[model samples]
Target: MSPEAGTGSPIGGTLPRPRSPATRDLGMRASLLFPDREVAERYYLPLIYTACRTCYSELEPQEIFDRATSGRVTTDKQQDLIRRVIESGHGSTIEHIVFTFAISGVTRTLSHQLVRHRAGVAFDQQSQRYLDYKRPSYMVPGTIADAPVEVRERYLAEMDESLAFYGEMLEAGIPGEDARFVMPNATRTNLIMTANLRSLIHMSGLRLCTMAQWEIRRLFQLIRHEIFTVSPFLGSFLAPKCVPLGYCDEDRNRDEHCPIRPHKDNVLAAWAEKRAAAKAKGREVPTL
Candidate 1:
């Protein structure tokens, strides 16, 4: 009997489930392609230092950059000033240096979400309209792959049928652009992503959150690992925003399901209680 036909079994009546933690290999890759560690260590920090120090120093930008790169200003001093400037919300200082990544094998679903970040970042994605895929690849979510054997086989068969139909369309003199209309969100693609340090940090803050979609969250994890390999100092800044803010702001996290940080509402409620106690003691407490 066809799996889709009711078989009077409990599994046949089950609803589709969310993606699970069944450890399916996603085959995603994020490689840092520009500014190796030595180059980044020598020039990247100096560049940002020049941008920041220009506000406080009489020296020309060139002079400051030369001083920073030539070690007239120690690395410690440069990093110290850069850290202070960044923590002070002076993001323009960090916008001077950029990192480039060669990202591959990610699903269209992940790429769609990734390209939503527009500020200080650029992307060149593989064009389905231009490249006629002779043998297209795709991703399968863990939940689908780990479902009951009959259900899993049925899902695979559907994916195979879709791709086969796409190929048949291409062979029947259909344009690649039109043929690609049949591709699923699981279709894999590549891209080149470039972003300034500030934008990378901002992107990471949201993508690295526990509440983020698993695939994109994993992609950011790889991105963070790549950054850490080159410059741990810069990578240190790539973390969930709540780590710095001390409270999670995600609406879905109000129930505190993923406890990477306390929910903002709970934190505010605690603060209100503290303030009430202080007011009762005739000592006024400052509001956050």
Candidate 2:
């Protein structure tokens, strides 16, 4: 495991770094569709293991992967190569390892943001027109879920009404394609997303941000859990943007309510303070 995986501790540990209350574990059955655990250990890591090795070794990448996966090369050597390549930000090597997910029970609103990633990923969403859901379900946001009974009842009623209207339209001889237009953003969806290691990290950085929509953020939380089940080392990369960046950059984080990490503004402020102190002592801080 990497020593520097999770975000660091703040002044008071009381602040909640808790995972989203809206998220739940549906298991890795939804996430590990591309390479199984044994396959990943035997081939995927070794593929990246080879990619990293080829940069330094006299041998070719194909040769390296063959040896590494076949147990000719030691696991330590493979991991050491992977570690250096990753730390140096040679992302192409890590891109060789991909993950396939059978994402289910997430909202259409979440799926919209997920599919926006145009690089190193592919997605095939369940067609609302073709797959007329016999039993549709929806996820209520934590804020709404915790609301008073009257408010919660009203919210659920509105969602029910929207789905009812879609069914009614379909029953009234409207085509499924046209009927789907009445479906609300609250409606659940399923998808198959296959993303390379680098893309997964990039997507996790964005979706796990405090600025991201709550529903999509929750989906990422679930996805991360699935990855953790198979491989903690690989799964550790799927953390919030601030965790990897060492500071939060979201515009809304200026107020610092989230408190997972110090905001970028805080880091800059500390740097400026140190510079001023140095200037007072007749020393100059070097500029980039």
Candidate 3:
């Protein structure tokens, strides 16, 4: 359960928006499509340079893109300078380098957590209303599937019942939107996501949190896997939110378990302890 959204509760009226479930690249590759390594190595930095410069310089956007994409500007220099600004949280520079993933086999439950990102990311999911599936499927979590055989059977039975009901609802001339009310959280879907580096980091932070739902966390695992395929350097940035933030803010982490990173409270406590120790030496630590 995601404490961020009040215990990963049923999305219900809280998330009124409907989205297409994307599921094209689950076990598949996100690399075989747009912005191949050649393009990324060549025009990517320049394209970003153009985007960043357009807002500041008198030159036209295409001219900037040309300067960056063409041999007029060097790629390493552009990337090096962009890294500094990105580190400083000057996010606009990253809006230029968008990665599109051919995402597949994720559930509607995960998608709700996904589309909450409002800035610098765009998603187009496959429509449920139009996709009259010959065979609609759902996922079974390992915990549930690995349960007692009868329990697993009961779980799958519920999923099958839900899918069967969805089809029956459609046959009864029910609207897809309302008919989808019968769909299980396990229903598989696909999407294509284009996110700037900043939003990508932000989403990775939340979804990668130990307290986040397993489905969304697994989706990020897939995203990281996809990123790793293209460039390990870039993939290095895709990690649990705490890896970059230096502390875990997820409320569920107050237990101090999941020790990949220290809880934010523990960090504060350590700082306080260190500050008291410094005061014993008659030197007070200055507030930032």
Best by lDDT: 1
**Every model: Cα RMSD to truth:** 5.3, 7.9, 8.6
1 versus 3: better lDDT goes to = 1
Sorting all predicted structures by lDDT, with the top scorer first, yields 1, 2, 3
Error (Å) of candidate 1 at residue 18 is 10
All candidates: TM-score: 0.90, 0.84, 0.76
Clashes in model 2: which pairs? none
Q: Model 3: per-residue lDDT, tens digit, 193-260?
A: 88877788788888877677766776777777666666555666778878867888888888878888
Candidate 2: deviation at residue 237, Å?
Answer: 1.3
Which candidate order results from sorting by TM-score in descending order? 1, 2, 3
Stretches of candidate 2 off by over 4 Å are 1-19, 22-29, 279-284
Report the CA-based lDDT of candidate 3 relative to the real structure. 0.69
Clashes of each: 0, 0, 11
Better of 1 and 2 by lDDT: 1
Per-residue error (Å), model 3, residue 127: 2.3
Q: Write candidate 2's Cα lDDT for 1-288 as tens digits.
A: 011111222222232333663443321125677677787777777888877878788987778778988889888777777777776779998888788899877778778888999999999999988877656666665445545667656877887887788778878888888988877786777899999989988899998787787667777777787778767777888888888678999888899988989999999999899999999999967889
- In Å, residue 115's CA in model 3 sits off its true spot by 1.4
Top candidate when judged by TM-score against the true structure: 1
